[model samples]
Target chain A: MMTTKNGSWKIRYILLLIALPVLALLFSLCVGRYVVSVPDVFRSILSRFNENIEVSKLAYITIWNVRLPRILLAFVVGSALSCAGLLFQSIFRNPLATPDTLGVAGGSSFGAVLSILLGFSLIPLQLVSFGFGCLAVFLTILAAKGKNQSMSTIILSGIIMGSLFSALVSLVKFTADQEQQLPSITYWLMGSLQSATYSSLLIGLIPIAVSIIILFLLRWRLNLLMLSEEESCSSGVNMPRLRMVAILCATVATASSISMCGQVGWVGLIVPHMCRMVFGNDHRHLIPACVSFGGTFLIIVDTLARSISAAELPISILTAIIGAPFFIFLMRRKGGWNL
Target chain B: MKLEIKNASFAYKNGRTLYENVNFSVESGEMISILGPNGAGKTTLLRATMGLLNWKSGGSLLDGDNIADMPASKLWSKIAYVPQAHNRGGSYTVLQSVLLGMTNQIGLFSTPKEKDIRFAEETLDRLHILHLKDRLCNEISGGELQMTMIARSLVSHAGILILDEPESNLDFKNQMIVLDTLTKLSSEGIGVLFNTHYPEHALRRSTKAILIDNGKVQFGATPSIITEKNIESAFGVKAYIGQFETEHNMIANVIPVGLTKDEEKTEANEEDSDVLATLSIICSKFEESERINAILHEFNDILFGRMGMPHRKRNLYLISVNLDGSKERIKMLAHQLSVLPDVSCKVTYAKEEES
Candidate 1:
């Protein structure tokens, strides 16, 4: 039964969602190549503040430098992508809408590959990718402008732009040297948090955090966006202005997340639906629920990606492997897309 | 508050004029019904008056101020719109859905406060749907959903409530519930305007009626404007106008008989003849006088001479009318008179002479 008496139960559910990610973060910090015990992990983390605590120097370096940034980056990137997906779905009024529906991911992928082909360093590569991701959406918007620029026209233009940029990505891949560059490009497209560093984390965090805050403040209005354009307008919402702001915020979040982690697919699309199953479709609860559940889900997936075998698998492969079955299970249990 | 549309004309982008020189005014506490056939620009006129559509000429004035110049927030604060009932499927609960109507009242970043929630609750209680506050909108029946929408609009405290066919696709009880709610709202000094296909609903509830047909509009009091002739001309259907005596007062009913195809030919041929008949209509009781009056007024085109006398002691009204038209017209008038329950009529035709 879907109860609408929102009281202590809602707060309890939200607290549980928040606790899951924190627990996942703790577990992920212990599951790397240099396995550190839970107590030792805490000591290593605590030793950063307290010099009196005796912890292994290797454990300190491993936990702080390698696993901590990777875990935090995965959580941030996941939360950013899922919230973007939620916003996009609300604005487009389509349950199937994702961050990449507006060509952001495709454009960023093209940019990342082009920068790699140009032999740019990691920081510049991510910057170029983020810039092109925004540019792709900008161009899509430009293409959709006309005498009567309907929502369908904008979505259609996004599809066209996505395909165009994807073709460009393939062209870049084709012209590159097959031995070193091609494999690197392919691995990069598959997505991983293996290169997570403090500088790279900082680079992605600023935009993601800003966009997230903006979306959080605008979350209540997102409920109105679920209504028809006429109803929203009649209800005193400036539909065009709100939609543009939402799109800009979602695009920024998505582009920044993709720049950090090459293309973590399905986290954006699936986490919100999963959250909706737990928390009802009201955006007030649904946005925060998506954030917590998404971060937890990706952290666990990243942990499994690094710990599953002797050679680490890409995060995308593990996400698809885990996410597809879970999605099918949700479909079977829920019977249909109630949202 | 008065919403006045002065000589408004609207043309579509395709150069098709939907309506021209449409003029009407609705004041606070007045219920106006826009009655017409499909494609008659009833919805178009409503949208144009609300400034949803750009009109070629003229404008809508609210309390002598142009509505176009007012900001949307201020405009929406004063005017609430309840669209058709079919737009009801959503995941929000009834209270949450109704709270959305306070969008203008609440700031952009703030959520609905306790006062706003109390207002929504009071509105739901007023509409007798308070028990449905926690139910998801999609889980409720269509009638309940319609009530929820009305409650939504009511919470906004809008002075003018415009509904687009609030009773469409509803069962008899649900339709009555919706119509009664609308009437109650209008009686509470909220100017109500609704467009509907049922002329009987217009006759029963509306203080004023606007009949739009073939790009032209006829606006006047409901009883004077919505007649058998207007219904037939507007919808290409023959209508019978009659009245029923309720416990409190007499209410008129417009019943559609069927479509008429050769009306133009019949009208043209009937104009050439002059057949005179005298109709003596007797209402058996005094309470049936209103029904008799409505029937006389409905067929007044052919009725030339009319006189009425009430037998006070016996509680009866005897009405005598002399009608001049073709033989078919006189017969049609007599046929209409014979249908009332307590009314009887005797028609005496003059013998034909060489002219």
Candidate 2:
């Protein structure tokens, strides 16, 4: 009886995951200002297989240049952030850990804000932000070391570094021109996928996809990290190499996702917990669940953000609106938010 | 299954050493109990054997192969380690906790196969706790927790079982249960080493004993060869030694009492006096007693070399004689004096040589 129920649940999860991207693609094409019918969207996507069939130039342009890139970027960034969150949570053995828990978001925001005030291009600003975010996470880890750095120490150090960086961002905001410079900085902080283009989307996909693949391959090793260091070592794990690879892979995922979506809050924190709640805590099933649910969750949130008003609401604001109450519920129920 | 530890030493980062120059070995199908006072590095020794601590001086060799060189998975397969079970947050079922013992057997990418489940079921059955397997660990009695730990160790298919204080913090019934399980395991040819504080516990089950004190191996011998003097030196205590009636067992019972300050000072003062002179004073002191004739008879026994008195004990009491110019004669004098109703006999040893 248990086996039968487990088998059906596995199939249900797989089917739901496969259907998500298709639904997201259809929603992205059909809900925009130039709304296309679902039948038209399907035909336009399939016409590439039959090149002899004539397709409208406008439909081709929307599918190729406008809508396709946004949907793909949302999936890539959602998967990256959720995977990063799962990695950090497992390493610290805390369900509350997210990409921002290590000051990655605040440091990246500080870099981007500094660049805008200094009149840098969007490309150079993103590069600087990504570089600074990785640097901040490493420095936080260093500050937390003792005889052996404990997980709680690392987490508290991350909080300190995050606050320090946030203070610097506030200082940057204080000196900027209110009408011209301030609004752009504020908009960037709010986070949006409306600025996504084919070029930026392709660039973000490389690091995100690579890191996700690394996460999947190292899923087995991640379970060992949940144990104490002595247990992990005696259980045959080469502790140093496992730690280095996991941190580097998780960092790549964090930096790329942050660069694409300017601090998309709470998806990373919430998705892993939701996955663990539905599935068990074992990373094999949990990691795949995070990927599917994370993307679907963000796609639906993004749809609400864009379709609710004439002007698209920032995705970050919407995540807080949903994530705050859910976060409280998770804390009360699972007792997993101690970090 | 010959486990040999030679010249093993360990120290913490703070420069306080837990153990140094330690050496011992145990053979297959043998039970060796590590007996020590509190803070005598018993747990440290167990951790070193389990490869949980970083050691400095030497290594533990299992059948001539260093434990450090063995692959972790194969090493665990040979040695089943049951860490001291403390309180954890969850109320995971007993069967689930035992299932976690099969963690290494289950591949990372795979679920538990039928064989793993069968092994767990069979272990619970062997422990006679199959009905309680579905109960939460928190809901069971302490006796059940101990049985579950033993069952967990058995499910690992480990040939050598290492437990730290398995009998500690357990009620008498649970302690006996754990000891019985260990005996059954050893009878099945599994090498077992466990740390214990109770000598009787070790004396009851283990054929061999290793005593540790001040981070040194005081004695490593079979139970038959373990004498009162050895235990006294190892634990710095006074002991009474005798034989058991039924089993020809040489029992060494240790008593942990030290001399009071005044008693210690008086013992130090008696060292300067000549033995002959002190015995002469004791004989004169008890010369006029009604028990004098009885004292003379015991003294004659000492004079004939049939019995002897230990030196320091003769000085403190008033009923010894100086006939042989030694305290052995004085002990005979005191034994005779002990028969008088008013005269009490007390024996003492010099502080340095007592243990």
Candidate 3:
């Protein structure tokens, strides 16, 4: 009976996590200034298949060109950040670890601000930010080497590298044009999905999807990374190779997401933790749970950010506001941060 | 399957040799216990044997193939390792934890199959912890946690299991339970190699004992290897090895007294003239007379005068002896006399010039 109960609970949680996102995607597609009905949204989508089905041209452009790409971008970016977060937590064996722990966000923000100050085009800006984010992680690893490669050493080096990158970002902001460049750079740092176009979605989706698939496929071995270095090695895990692959995938996903959407925080850190609390810490279940819940959670937050006031708010502001209180609730409910 | 460590040597990066030329082999259905004091390289030896650390000289062979040449997954599938009890900390259920041992059996990207789950269940049942299968590992007692770890290793279906101090943190009953489980596993044809601080445990459960002292290793059958002389030299303590009959069979126990410091000091003063010592022996039961006689006969070189009186009503034997010998020799004779069951010996020494 207990065995069956456990098996059924896992299946049910997985189904709920997956279904909730699809439902949220559909629901969010309806809630906006225009307030399209759910059936209208479905009819608009169905009109693509049956040309005879009558749908307004305005609805078609709003749904297909505007809302769909933005929502899809939000979902991909959210799930990518969450997957990177899970990878970081497992490989570092520290629950507090996130995609930003290795200075990816800080380095990418600096690169974005520098590009804005130099009057670079949008594509070059994204490429520059992605390159700098990866470079920051590489430098962090280089600093952490030759000290037995302990987790604490790597974490300490990451903190130092993160601070250095943040300082560089501050320097870039200080030197920018006060009227034109500074405000734009500050707004970009706040993070938003408002600029989510079909091209931006296409650019970020492939790497994020590829990385998430890799993480999902290797979910079982991710459990081994939770063990100590010696224990994992003795258990037949190639610790260095596994860790390198995981970090590389996580970095690619995080950098691509940040380069597209600027610096969206808290989703990466909090989504994985919330998933762990609900579905236990087994990565096989935890990874999918994070992907689903994270995608749905960000889409809802972005919807609220857009609708909460007349002017749109940045996605990061809403995520931190919601994420901080929920994290506190989780900590209080669990009695302490055991992780 | 057989595991052989042939002339294996290990040293730290700073050039201090932890152990050298350590040679031993264990086969299926055999248990080898490594005994040593704290910081005696016991853990290092185990790590070296498991290939967690590379050896500087020589290597291990599994079934005549070099272990180093084998892939880690292949070698680990044949030889499972369990770290110390304290190192296991997590929220995985007993079932999930044990299923982790199937790391090698399952594909890198694949979850456990139905047959892997069945194997894991059978392993838990074999360890008699099937009832704990659903319980979280951290919520279980330490002894139960230990059992789960062993079950985890067993689920891999490894032919050999190497544990580091499996009984260190447990209470007496739990210690016995863990040891007994290991013994049972060995009987089922799985080789068990563990390091422990308790020589009595090694004597009871281990088929072979390896005593590492001061960079040297002594390996042999448990009974022959765990002798008083070896124990004294290894641990600097005087020990007595004796056998007692239980309802089932005879069991050997090693009783270690404090270090032989007094004997060493007296031996330093051996140039002094021999002393005349008088030893009074009392036996509460008549059955102990033969053992007391044998003990005295073994020390006959120091015997000068001996007298025995049997009190038939009390069924006790009282013997008194005067001996001329060095203080060390006299003390050894008295010590032997005191070790016999139901017998006690007291000695009085008086300095005398040689005549």
Tens digits of lDDT, candidate 2, B1-355:
7888888888887888877887887776678788877788888888887777767879888888888888877777777777666532134457665665666777754555677777888999988898877776656887788787778777778778888888988888889888888877775678889998777676656756778866777444344324454555556654554433222122334344552343322222134321432222233233334345444564563342222232354432234433443453454344334322234433333333333
Q: Which stretches of candidate 1 lie above 4 Å from their native place? A: A1-7, B263-355
Instruction: Pull out the clashing pairs in model 1.
Output: none
Fraction of true A-B contacts recovered by candidate 1: 0.40
Considering only chain B, what TM-score does candidate 2 achieve? 0.68
Candidate 3's TM-score = 0.84
The TM-score values for the models, in the order shown, are 0.87, 0.73, 0.84
Which residue pairs come into collision in candidate 3? Answer: none
Model 2: DockQ against the native? 0.08
Q: Rank the candidate models, highest DockQ first.
A: 1, 3, 2
Over A1-339, each residue of candidate 1 has an lDDT whose tens digit, in order, gives 223556778678767987999899999998877788999999999999999999988999999998999999999999999999888887787778989988999999999999999999899999999999999999999999988898889899999999999999999999999998999999999999999999998999999899888878776677788776666677866778889998998999999988888999899889988877776667777778888988999999999999989898999998899889988999889887756
How high is the lDDT of residue A138 in model 2? 82
DockQ of each: 0.33, 0.08, 0.31
Between candidates 1 and 3, the one scoring higher on DockQ is 1
For candidate 3, give the lDDT of residue A41.
93
- The i-RMS of candidate 2 is 5.0
Evaluated with TM-score, which candidate comes out highest?
Answer: 1
Q: Identify the runs in model 2 with alpha carbons over 4 angstroms from their true place.
A: A1-6, A20-29, A32-37, A47-64, A114-120, A143-146, A167-179, A334-339, B68-77, B87-158, B169-177, B197-200, B219-355
* TM (chain A) per model: 0.97, 0.90, 0.95
Q: Which prediction has the highest DockQ against the true structure?
A: 1
- Please report how far candidate 3 places residue A126 from its true position, in Å: 2.0
